[model samples]
Target chain A: MKDFPGTPGTLTGLMLRVGQFTFAAASIAFVATGVRFQEFTAFCYLIASMGLQVLWSLWLACLDAYAMLAPRDLRNPRLVSLFVVGDWVTATLSLAAACSSAGILVLYDRDLGNCKESVCQRYQFAIAMAFMSWVLIDISSLIMFWLLAAG
Target chain B: MKDFPGTPGTLTGLMLRVGQFTFAAASIAFVATGVRFQEFTAFCYLIASMGLQVLWSLWLACLDAYAMLAPRDLRNPRLVSLFVVGDWVTATLSLAAACSSAGILVLYDRDLGNCKESVCQRYQFAIAMAFMSWVLIDISSLIMFWLLAAG
Candidate 1:
């Protein structure tokens, strides 16, 4: 099998995990700061999704740190399988949540024209952050997927 | 690395690919049948996403079928890496589109309360199918990721 740059337990992998965690956490914080987010189911779902992502990414980051400090490589088949499943699930949920929230934001801005300047700007900022987080997760997910496939 | 089920080019993998294609096609069909879906950006995005999914899944299914018929292991690192990237990209798009469309559906059903029963049901079905497609793709993605890591 060809060696990949971001295999689990490596410094590259640790950095990717940290990126995922930071982006997801920031997305949640931005959305939470927005006023009246709970009024919409999509917004609530986005929070829930980002919360899950934060937890998952944090756990993996800790695991990556441990592996980096330890001697043994952590790219065993069973463990990588577990990581793949977790990453895919979280990635799916995060994308779904982000997209749904954006859809509603567009509706408010374009269709209803009800979003006044301040609140609408918050919504757009939150949604954009969520998308950024999703992009990070997607990249991580793809790397993990590649590692597993090459095995 | 221990052998895992649903490796690319296996029977299980073929079934998964077929499921992805079927659900994505069904989602597009349902949304296309619905009246006024073109008016919403979310719906249009959903259609485009599903269309991409159908093409990707179908291509993979054909590849799987050929591998099954031939004696090749079809677990080549390069090929699997390509599959991983394709699956992740399609999976991300599918989930985003589905979630956004679902958000609009929720807004119409709950907040605005303007959806007629029939149209609402159609919209709900289309979104549900889109979700189904995402689930299948997620499963396939997880399997592919595991295989690569194991290598």
Candidate 2:
């Protein structure tokens, strides 16, 4: 199997994990800090999903850092399989949360005309951050899937 | 590699594909028939995503049917990789569409109180069907991923 840049236990993989964690945390912070976010179920779902992403990415980032520092291999088939499953699950949840929140934002901002401009902006920013996190997770999930295939 | 029930060219796989197609079509039918669905971008997105699912599932179902009747091998590594990628992409899109639509439905039905009872019911039904389609796609995507891993 050819080595991929974002393969688990590598510096690149650690960067990707950290990126996911940062974006997810930012997303949560943006939404949670705003007024009335808790009133919307979609926003709450986004917070929950991003919270899960934060934990998953933080855990993996730590693992990747440890593996690099300890000079350990992280390509065991069982471990890779676990990574693949976890990434897929998180990627799916993250995408769903982001998309759902975006849908609600669009409704509130455009069609419904219920949201204040400032609140809408904040929600949009949070959704965008969630999407950024999802993109990183999606990439890492694809990498993990390919690694499992090659293994 | 152990044989899985939903591998791309098998009878069970064909059934799964058919189920996905049927549910996606049902979702579209329910939403499209309802009045004012086009007014909501989330509903439109759902229609578009389910349309893609319908086409993809129908194409693959035909392929699965042909492969089974002809007794052709469909377990090539490259072919499985293609299946994995396709399934993952469609699964993600399907789930996003379903979830986003559901979020909007919740907003309309619960928070905003703008939706009429009958319309809300129809929309709810359509979203449920979309979720059904997503579930089947998720299952097949997982099977394909595992197939790639076992390959």
Candidate 3:
């Protein structure tokens, strides 16, 4: 897959998965750290969405690590198909959650001026992290989608 | 694609593409009809995202129509890759915009009790349409991802 730099089961694959996991976890942490995020449905949804991303990325990262140790090509068509589907699903969910949360920030913090400066900063930070995670997820899905096709 | 009932150059594909276009357009129309949607960046983003979806889906629907009339396989790997990438990108953007807008609705209408009946209903309708569009997009992406892999 031209989109993906490392073949499956290699160190590159492991690193890619790890990057996904780390970003997702960081996004979740930043969002969770915000005070009273549970008060808003969008924030809660963001947490749930990022939580799913974290789990998915962690699972894949572990799989990649195992694959690395085994030194096996994780390019089996069926497995690739599974990976493609998983990546797409997670990518969709993550993007949705991040964007929705960002909307909230824009509405409350920017437009309405409801949030104070300090609180607004937190929201901004969390949403920024979420977007970062989303970028990673999108890249990963693009690669997986291509790999599934080309494999 | 097991999930997709239509072949690329068949009525099913044409129908699917039409479905995508209709839902995306509907989502955009509903959102656009809302009062003061542009006041919020999230709502504006929603409009932009849905607008893109409408264009992509409409374009693909036309291609599908052409393929049906011409009765070509439309299974070229490169073309399939392009379709896969396009579908995933739109899917990601649409889902994000929809979810973010929904988050605003939930926060303002449900949590804060800001919007009253008529306006709240409009927001709800728009968000629902957006969600409907997202479902179609997800299904299409899933099918395209699978097709690219299989092709």
State which candidate has the highest lDDT.
2
lDDT of 2 at B113: 76
Q: Tens-digit lDDT track for model 2 on A78-125?
A: 898899889989998999899989999887777777998888888899
Clash number for each model: 14, 0, 1
Question: How does chain B score by TM in each prediction?
Answer: 0.96, 0.97, 0.92
Give one digit per residue, the lDDT tens place, for model 1 in A15-57: 8778878877877887788898887888889889988988998
**How far off is residue A139 in model 2, in Å?**
2.0
lDDT (Cα atoms) of all candidates against the true structure = 0.83, 0.91, 0.77
How well does chain A score by TM in each candidate?
Answer: 0.93, 0.97, 0.92
Best by DockQ: 3
In candidate 2, residue B17 scores what lDDT? 99
Candidate 2 has an fnat equal to 0.64
The segments of candidate 3 whose C-alpha lies over 4 angstroms from its true place after superposition are A1-7, A70-82, A148-151, B1-7, B70-73, B77-82
Model 2: CAPRI class: medium
Better of 2 and 3 by DockQ: 3
Tell me the tens digit of each residue's lDDT in model 3 across B36-125.
878888888888988898889888888888876776667776787788789878877877788888888888888898788897887788
